[model samples]
Target: MGSRQLESFVTERCRSGTLTVTEACHLFDRLLTTRDPAPTIYPFNHLFTTLVRMNNLTNHYPTIFSLFNQLTQTNQISPNVYTYNILINCCMRVDRIGLAFVLLGRALKEGPGSNPGVFNPLLKGLCKDSRIHEAAAIVLDKMPKLGCTPDLFSYNTLMNGICKMGQIGKAEELVDYMVSKGLQPDVVTYTTLIDGLCKKGLLDKATQILQCMISKDLEPNVVTYNALMNVLCKKGEIEKAEELLDFMVSKRVQPDIVTYSILIDGLCKKGLLDKATQILQCMISKDLEPNVVTYNALMNVLCKKGEIEKAEELLDFMVSKGVQPDIVTYSILIDGLCKKGLLDNANQMVQCMISEGLEPDVVTYNALMDVLCKKGEIENAEKLLSFMVSKAVQPDIVSYTILIDGLCKKGLLDKANQMVQYMISKGLEPNVVTFNVLMDMLSKKGEIEKAEELLDFMVSKGVQPDLVTYNILIDGLCKKGLLDTAYQMVQCMISKGLEPDVVTFNALMDMLCKKGEIEKAEELLDFMVSKAVQPDIVSYTILIDGLCKKGLLHKAEQILQCMISKGLEPDVVTFNALMDMLCKKGEIEKAEELLDFMVSKGVQPDIVTYNVLIDGLRKKGLLHKAEQILQCMISKGLEPNVVTYNALGCTAQTKRN
Candidate 1:
């Protein structure tokens, strides 16, 4: 047979999946030895592609590299762009990304002119490593300059990676760019964007995309519906999720395990344990048995809700249905038991899981260690850290953080600092939780400057501070009366897209009020509202208390009425502030009337309320009226403490004088 015929024979076999690694390699040798007219690069490309496909099973990746080297040495045939693409795929599969880029540079400079097909795999490698910005630059800018503009597949790949990072806005922008360059968004594009929107809790935009897909006659598939349903379930819109499922069924799109699992998890999160169980049964009736992931999702929510008994029963039921409980299942129950303060039960669970040959991972050890630490059993928690190491379970950030937190709780600053240094030395950078703990420690000790420096250190290490970190620092700044710095930090967070939450606003407002900047505090309340942040009870209470302290009785009562108008009933503290102001003005009757009003509103007055009343009546020399107030306080099953006794003692001393 001619070289072309032989090459065709090999390509046909390789493509048909009948070609073995040995046979493909032998055929290539025969093609190479037919020296009359050596086989074209087709056979070599096919053989390389075939070997790369089997790389996962036979570890033939290195063999492909050696064979390619052999082909180059033969000088009978040169590698084609297809050959380079296969090599790139192999490099990516083994995570040799640097080598893949080197091969790409060679393919661009030495091989036949590059095409979008050649750049796609390189894009995939860069994206898989989360080198998104680099990937975007190559596909959108670098490749097009080489006359290889990104195709639909190329755009879809970048979009998927961008979506995975929860960068939905950038993904959408890429879609517009793709369309501007004449590539239309497909179902995969829409589905990926939906998933990203769901992650960011942008349900309205996701649903709009869903409708847009249907409007374009692209046909919303099961994946699209699952994405939409998953978001709905997460938002506690279980009814809407069910309606979506019904809509999916009406469109002849069947719900898969993922669709049902999302629903089950959503129901579980909403504390509808029974509803979640029914969905599990429904999926079973449809012959789609619940997998380990489904059971874990259900049990995890149950465990989080402190329903350990229900979670255990679910595990038993899962096992009875021949579905094995995995490590996550046991970890969830163990965590729940530990949180419920059932350490012995947690230990027994560990032993039981070990007997079943399921080794405890770092997460399992963290759970046990956390409970022990919280119980102030730091020594026992420390031993657990060592025991996990003995079992070949390496400590993760959480394990060390749990230990450090225990030491911190016990005021072992030096030990906790050592643990942090040890983790850093081991190449595990501190995550937001670890940094938050450190920042809180410094902030509480009035080390605001050091805490801010630590924030800068965290950013230098590429760890972004979350809202909790900002809240801690802002609160610290407010405590140190660094109002200007605190305000600057709030603006900094807003610029970083970390919008000020109620905790952030509350901290700033309380500080402003303390500095007698009540007007500025009121302006902040208006600012938070303009930003769509609803003022919570704490926010209202702070304003009322602030006004009352400034002796603005009429203004304080007006604020109280405004709070009630907004459907926020004043708590005892709000009432106590108002009554204190009235008592200072010698309006004992008005203060007593305010107490009766608070009781009528079902806002139970604490001992502080009774003490305020007794102190007011005693200063007015109405000892008999103070005694009636004490009797009233005792009648409500309330105990009088030091403040109550002090007020009554002054009344007796005044009578003797």
Candidate 2:
């Protein structure tokens, strides 16, 4: 057959959806032998397009590349932009992104009436590799400059990439740009944004986006509802999720298996197991079978509540329903067993998993190792590591981290350092978390210089210091009374775009309080509030304790009232600190009233409270009253420690005086 006849055969077969891989290749091979009237690029485009869409057992990508190369070199036909797009797509799917971009560069140079479709694959490839900025640049600059105006596909692909990488602001900008270009936001666009916003915990904004989509007369698909529902469920807003489900049903959107699963999972998380079971039954009544994901969620909640036998029964139920347990299912069971300290049973579960031909993954191994480390069985943990290596399961960063943390807690710093080195040698670079652990331990041990060195080393290694890293250094400096240096570290973190969180402010406030710089600590508090960092209960307690120690009873009481105004109920420690100061001031009557107030407010006083009251009575020359208080404490079932008797010793001394 002639080249055009061969081309027509391939094109017809492709268009009719009857083209087999073998048949396409045979025709392409036949075309390469054409001597006259060579075929155009249309035939090659058709075949490559079909091959990529098929994506079967064979490596059709390499075949596409090979056929393109041979036909171009041997035939008199010229390759067009269509051929380049296909080749670029093929390169992308195989992760040869560099080659895809190279093809793009060649296409831009050839300049055959630039096609936006040409850059879609390139954008997709970049996004898949997490090269988001480059993808955005191509959409905003390269495509337009090359006369390939950004299309809906181009915008959607880049937006999805941005959202995945936690760049929600940029994704929103892309949506605005999409609308400005007159490409109305489609269902996919709305769904992607909602998913991103939901993931970022911007649930209210995500709901607004949904409302906007509805106003625009765009019907949300199951994917859109699922994304929003999943986040709401995750936030433990089961009631909100149910309301959303009702709204979804009102709009004629059917609740698929995923929707039911999400509802079940959400209810389970809120400890409403009966509600979850009802949802599961509702799902089954609709002829929808529950999968392992649905069962896993219920079992996980049961395990968390320490109802392992109930979880086991659920697992059996899952299996009877023909839903074979996967790795996640077994991992949950193993974690449940480990948490209950059933080490032997946990090991047996692992064996059972293996017996069912499911190999335990890194997560499963990490879970086992973490339990072992916490139990102080370092040798057993190390043995598990060796077994993992024997099974060809290379340990990830978490495995080494767990061992390091265990060693550090046991004061085996040298062993922990050795493990860090070994992990690095195994080609796994420690992330921010690993460094944070090491720095925290070193700082606590007064190894401030070494901790500072680690910060510098991590920076040099191209790992930017996060808030936790800076907070550690600041706290370390504060503990050493290096206030100026700690302030400098806080400022440095700010310059690095790390805002001072409540923890950072608290550390500074604590150091200031310790130095009797109450005024300065209060200023820091104001600064934290101005910066929108609300002080936690610890922050208030520190200031209150500092004022109480300074004998500023009125000022301390004001701080206590302020805390209460902010809805922070004073804990036992806060009350004890205040009562101790009152007793020392010889205001035993007022201290007694404060003790009654704490008890009436449901803040139970401990032995410390009684000791303070007894000591106050002794100082007030009321030995009989102090003895009656001690008897009351004993009657209340509090075991008096040396402090209680020491107060009586001081009472005898007072009598002698």
Candidate 3:
């Protein structure tokens, strides 16, 4: 059979999808034995090109190369432009740009019987595969010497490749070259350059190029405006992007679905929900139906701003508009519900996704698991985790972190630790938040040493500790009566360039007070105030109680006076402590004065306050005064507790004597 018959046979087989490598090789071998003087090049080239296309599709580059060699060397069949195009496409697909260049050189120099047609495929292939420089070299230098001129497709392809490579300078030069050679760049050429500049975040340059294209009488297409709009929106230039949209419509360039979607997403991200809603209305007004992407963008914004009711309303509107919510839509609602601590509602939405035939992606499950874990529903989280594993949804670092944090919060430290180990075994690294959670739990359990070891482990793992981590450790040490160690930790935190915040100062103050180091605690309190760190109620309360416990009643009174002077009004606990101390020292007059001052300040005395006052009067043998205060307390709707009754009974016993 002739080459035409052989090619026809291969084309038919390829289209039928029944062609095998062994069968093709056999057919090509038989065709090689033909002794026809005028061999038909068309059929042989077509057969070879078809085989090359098949090999490229299957990513069998080597097979395509071997076949190319067989056709040229074994069969003595001349290669054509079509043959070179196929081979270069394969090379480009495999990212073998250098090998593609070598083949282009061979095609340029060693044409079919040393002709120019062989180089046509090489140049066309380079252009199609976006090898701009090689195409330019052949078109500008080598092809002209061979008396071959590149067509408009080749020029446009070369321009696109150059622009895409961000060598816009060279691309502009190529455009100039094309115009000099009596060629005008079409919309594709301009769009390519415009898209290229936009991708590089050079919006101004892209706009300049668009103006240049317009000056050249090339009207901007929907794609041109879309690219510009997307770039402008991403840069937070929404007003300019909107102006462009108006300009596009005025210029008779219709906006596509993507154009509206981009603007909606941009406005939603900027928290311009009203503006986003306006754009959605405009999109519908223009008879351009909003897509799922548009609805999802609005939904995500509403969900993030805690507008779940509005988000759900929009979702219903989306469904009514015949736009189905995709994975992103479900994920947004799930995440929102989870954040609001409504796990059951979140799970129902997830089930809705599944009922709609949408398999929950890792993000959907992770959000659900996070909510369950955060709500201390570890059993449900573990069950979901098992379901995820069974469904082949591999657990990422976040999944492990959520579970670990939950376990630690529930005081299941050993299980939490095991999870950390499991995460490492799975080749996932625990992040800073993970360590902080574990450290906080350990500290709360009085395992200050273990918590410190974890902190050290975090450092060893190259995870830098944040302020919360340091505060947890300091508070733990202080609670365990290790004031010096807690103080040293504060120094360490400062050395690490982390300024001690209110929590750090409070921890230190608490430690000193617990250790009876009232003087140091007062000094630290002074420093805290000077640093503009307002002492919280706990800080003032701790210092006051500490001084009173040490029998330094004058100093304790001074601190209380100073606290009030600083506009820090004492709470009920503060008054109770002072009263308890005064009554214990038998200072009835001073104690009564404090009680009167407390009442004058509108600080109603609680049961403890009344009990303290009654006990003080009874101890001083002022039974009449003590009984009168008890009656005043009862009349004021303050019930006498067991302590009050005991104090009153003591006064009654004294009265009977």
Best by TM-score: 1
Model 2 over residues 331-407: C-alpha lDDT tens digits?
99998888887888888999999999999998888889888988999999999999999999999999999889888
TM-score of model number 1: 0.61
The CA lDDT at 242 in model 3 is: 95
> Which candidate, 2 or 3, would have the higher lDDT against the true structure?
2
- C-alpha local distance difference test of each model: 0.88, 0.88, 0.83
Q: What digit string (tens of lDDT, one per residue) describes model 3 on residues 256-304?
A: 8899999999999899999999988888898999889999999999999
Give the TM-scores of the predictions, in the order they appear: 0.61, 0.60, 0.52
- The per-prediction CA RMSD against the true structure, in angstroms, equals 9.2, 9.6, 11.6
Better of 1 and 2 by TM-score: 1
Candidate 2 accuracy as TM-score: 0.60
